[model samples]
Target: MYRAIRIHGYGGPEVLQLETLPTPVPGRGEILIRQEAIGVNYIDIYFRTGLYKVPALPAILGMEGAGIVLAVGADVTDFEPGDRVAYPTSLGGYGECRTIAADRIVPLPPDIPFDVAAGGMQRGLTARMLLREVYAVRPGETILVHAAAGGVGLLMCQWARHLGVRTIGVVSSEEKGELARRNGASDILIGYDNLAARVRKLTDGAMVPVVYDSVGKDTFVASLDCLAPRGLMVSYGNSSGEVAGISVRMLATRGSLYLTRPGLTTYIAQRGALLGGARDVFDLIAQGVLRVHIGQRFALADAGAAQTALETRATTGSTILLP
Candidate 1:
């Protein structure tokens, strides 16, 4: 038997319950991982609250983890028993043991710890795609990041700095602003009231070339105004709410700006894609060019509290769950 967190009916964090289930065995092209650490993300809240739909009830809702491989299914040769690996599994990550496709698992480097590995995959890969893939953020280029003290923000800020890029981070408070500045932001602004104007003033009347927006709905229209002519708006998440009622004509009106909703799945759809994206993230962490800060830790049983912290925007950096 193995322990896992599951929800039969989705509503709130209170719905997360710990239950024992029969241990799963790896089938063809699969592996069973004994989880060491789990990455807690805002999307987990969406899944719990039914904002994101799952095919069935009684779901195990988590997206990423790091663990030791206990068994590998037939035809798997790159990994063996006791191998340490980290994966960005699309589901079933909020458990003591998770079964994943063999190709989805990446062997962990010696210098990367379990807690760091789990935290790095989701957020670090996000930073990778944002800087290296989305618009190919270049040295000396300026970009804006929402929730600039959150997990992805911190990682992106550091990597952006390493690339000699300038970052304009938007935060909710002075404290978060300081955190953003410390993470390599050239400037930080409070995420309220005339946000685009603030960015314009900070950039000397020239807004950022790209704006990395995750707080959707509440900031979508404003984010459009924060971009420079022909800028890219990378809307990857919706912690505040989902972006709604998008009008394609607005793109033409808004200086021919480019908008996209990028996700890890699309960015890493195949092994080659995964390898390309994961290598950038893992190498940065391995070389100290990027830092993954785990700001909150919850026991497997306290998953509810972790979700509450994230949904309320009450935590910074990354949140992790220990099994």
Candidate 2:
């Protein structure tokens, strides 16, 4: 038996329990992997808090993980036992091992570590899609990245810089601001008190072409106001809380902004899309351009505390669970 963080009744971090279960067998189009690490996002907290409705009780709590394939289904031909892989599965990632659909798994770049690959998948892939598909940033264009020191934020800042785009980062604390700066944010703003004003200043009275926001609620309106004419508001995650309803006219009034709520699953709907998008992340990692910060780590058994820390915003960078 192997221990996994399983929740019988979703409620709070306290409810995440470590329970042992028999090893699972892979089905057609699936592979069983012994997880080396689990990537814990605030979305896990949302699942625990009932914000994101999940299935029946007693479910394992993870969306992404990295490991070595232990077994392959008879129909699976792309991967074999012992291949190092990482994946963003639809569910059940907190286990020591899992049977995941092979297409959801991607081979790791030679130099990337298991923890880093796990750390980078969901967030990094989200950033990749946001930049390449959501609005398609161009060189010399200015963009605003909210929570620019967080997991996805760091990747966006670096990846955008690599594309020769300038970014004005929005962060809560000074420490996070410094982190965003190191990650290639051209400038950083603290708080939403004078957000649009700061962004205007950064761009010399001209706002950015796009605002990538995960810090919803508190920053949504200001993020909208900071956009230049026809800019896009890419509201990817609700780290602050789900964004409230807005008037349709506000989109036109606020620079005719385009609002998009994108998730990794939607962005990679095509099998071809998955491989292409994931390859971008792998290439960035292979070239040493993407530096994922594993700022916090918890043993698989300590998933509860990790969830608590993430929910309270007491942690930064990518937090992971070592199995």
Candidate 3:
């Protein structure tokens, strides 16, 4: 038997309940993992709150984890018992043990700690998709990032800096701004009040070429205004709230801007792409080019409190559950 956090309804963190479940058996092409660490992300909150629908009422909610394989089902060839692995795009990670399709997971590098892998897998993969595929940020280009001290935000800052790109980060406080600076943000803005004007001053009235906004409804308009003519607005997350009632004319009026909502699943749907992206992220970690902070650790049964902390913005960097 293993413990799992399941939600029977869409609501707040209290909906997440800890219960004992039978250790699952792996079916065809599946591997049963004894999870060591699970990632806690905002998407889990989205599902719990019904902003993002769950497939069923009673369901598991986590999407990323690192673990050791205990069994491989029929027809599985690439992995075996005792293999170290991690997955960034799979669900049902809020458990002590879970079964997943073999192709959805990647080998965990020997040097990467299980907690580090769990902490950064999803966020790092999302950052790779954003900085390399979505906008393909060029060196010497200055871009704007929202929630600069956040899990994904800090990774993007460090990764973009490594690529020679300058980041103008928007954070909520001076402390967060300092953290972002240490992670490679060139400049920082404390809040969104008069955001465009402040960005203009920072850029000498030139504005930026891209704005990577995860703050959603609270800052999309201000982020749009921070872009240069023909700049791209990457609205990837909804931290404050979901953005709604957007008029297409808003794009036209805002310098003919380009907007995209990309997710990690879409970028890594292909087996080759999945492995390649994971390899890149792991390689960077191995080379010390990227550092993921495990800012908060919660026991598996304390999943509700963990989600609450993440939703309230009371935690920074990557939060994880020790299973």
Candidate 4:
């Protein structure tokens, strides 16, 4: 038997329960993984609090993990026993052992450690999708980022800098601002008050072509105001709360702004896309172009605490759970 964290109903962190279950056997097209590290992310909190629905009750609650494959089911030819692999977005990750679709897992590079792999995969791919695909940021362009010291925020700042873009990062405190600056944020704003005015000052009143906003509700309007005409507002997360009660006319009034709530899954829905995106993320990490900070580690049984830390903005960089 192996241990897993499961939630029977939606609520706070206390709803997370650790229980023992029989080890799963791989089904057709699946592989049984001995999960070494589990990633803690805000999305997990979303599912936990009923903001996002799980397929059923008593579901294991984690989106990403790194592990060694111990068994491959029938017709699974690409992976075998003892292969080191990781997945960026899959349910049932908050367990000591679990079976996942084989195609969802990627081989870990020799240079990338398991902890780093688990920590960086989702956030790194998210940064890639936001920077390269969604807005396709150009060099010399200034962009605004919310929660800039957070996981995806930090990665986005660094990756954008690597591509010659300037980031105007909005952080909650001076300490977080300093962290964002160290990770390539060209400018930092502490707190959300007068956010657009502050951004306008930083960008010489030209505003930015895109605003990457993960803090929803509280900063949505200010983020929209920080954009240039016809700019894209990539509202990818909701750390503050879900964005709501906006009409289509809001976009028109906001200088014809384009808004998108893109997730990593849609950006990498295909097998080729998944492998390609993961490869890019791993390559950048391996080459030291993107530095992943494993800021906090928790025992698998303490996943509730990990999620609470992430949800409360109490942790920085990446938080992982060790099994």
Q: Could you say which candidate leads in lDDT?
A: 3
Give all TM-scores, in the order shown: 0.97, 0.97, 0.99, 0.99
Cα deviation at 224, candidate 1, in Å, is 0.5
State, as a TM-score between 0 and 1, how close model 2 is to the true structure: 0.97
Candidate 1 ranges beyond 4 A from true positions: none
* lDDT at position 38, candidate 2: 94
Q: Measured by C-alpha RMSD in angstroms, how accurate is candidate 2?
A: 1.2
Tens digits of per-residue lDDT for model 1, 85-166: 9987568898999899988878888788999988879899888888888879888888898998999999988988999999
Of 1 and 4, the candidate ranking higher by lDDT: 4
Show model 4 residue runs off by greater than 4 Å.
none
Clashes of 2: 0
lDDT of each: 0.89, 0.88, 0.94, 0.92
Against the hidden true structure, what lDDT does model 1 obtain?
0.89
